[model samples]
Target: MAVQGTPEPFVEILMSTVVALVRRDGPDLSARQFGVFLTVYLGEGPHTVRGLAKELNVSKPAITRALDRLGVHDFTHRQVDPKDRRSILVQRTVKGAALLREIRAIMGEAAAASDEAAPGGATELRRQHA
Candidate 1:
């Protein structure tokens, strides 16, 4: 069943990639958690709760909640920022890097599938699968 929304090419790729992610045997993260995970991994670091909240345009509570979930999976861990002594730094883990690789692979497969399924879909592929 197709979802009722604007049918953009990237949307199709996103749906396909998400479907693959759900079917796989691994941590199932919500959109928020995944966003936070990617942001911490993909972007430059020294990432604190405040930094993530600002970067993601979400509330600190929301970032904390997402981090709580990511922590359960060991994808990320919270550390007291030594320099600041007042902020919690959201640090990435080896497990989280593995997940990022998996996501890249899944997104690449989905993008290729999207291109094949719809010739000239022109779906911009995942950024080198990260």
Candidate 2:
């Protein structure tokens, strides 16, 4: 396990995972779009554009733009909030869940490969760089 406060191992794992994911052929999402997607799926919903904007520290227009792209991919959908006609709720779809699963699998494979490549796993890789 990584020692408390040291982010090297975590960074290494994330970098490797991103590299592996980027190499795959599929919808290439922008950073904002990816962030919105992750937030919607991983967070408690029903999410609102305004809520997401606050949580993500961005403008409502920014969240809406990201949601626009996500909607085009069918990864998410928006609905009129019954309680508040002025608000829209972001909802997840089966396609989004499937994509999340695929991303998880890709990251797992990349992490395993990274572990196998080093003698002492991420620690060893860090030592070499240090």
For every model in order, what is the number of clashing pairs? 0, 0
lDDT digits (tens) for residues 2-28 of candidate 2: 577675555677887677678878788
Give the C-alpha lDDT of model 2: 0.86
Q: Clashes in model 1: which pairs? A: none
Per-model TM values vs. the true structure: 0.84, 0.82
Off by over 4 Å in 2: 1-6, 119-130
lDDT of each: 0.87, 0.86
Q: Where's the lowest-lDDT run of ten residues in candidate 1? A: 121-130
Residue 78's lDDT within candidate 1 is: 96
TM-score of 1: 0.84
lDDT leader = 1
lDDT of 2 at 70: 96
Model 2 is weakest, by summed lDDT over 10 consecutive residues, at 1-10
User: Model 1, range 1-130, lDDT digits (tens) per residue?
Assistant: 5575555567878888899899999878989998999999999998999999999999999999999999999999999988888999888899999988988998888778788887766353344233
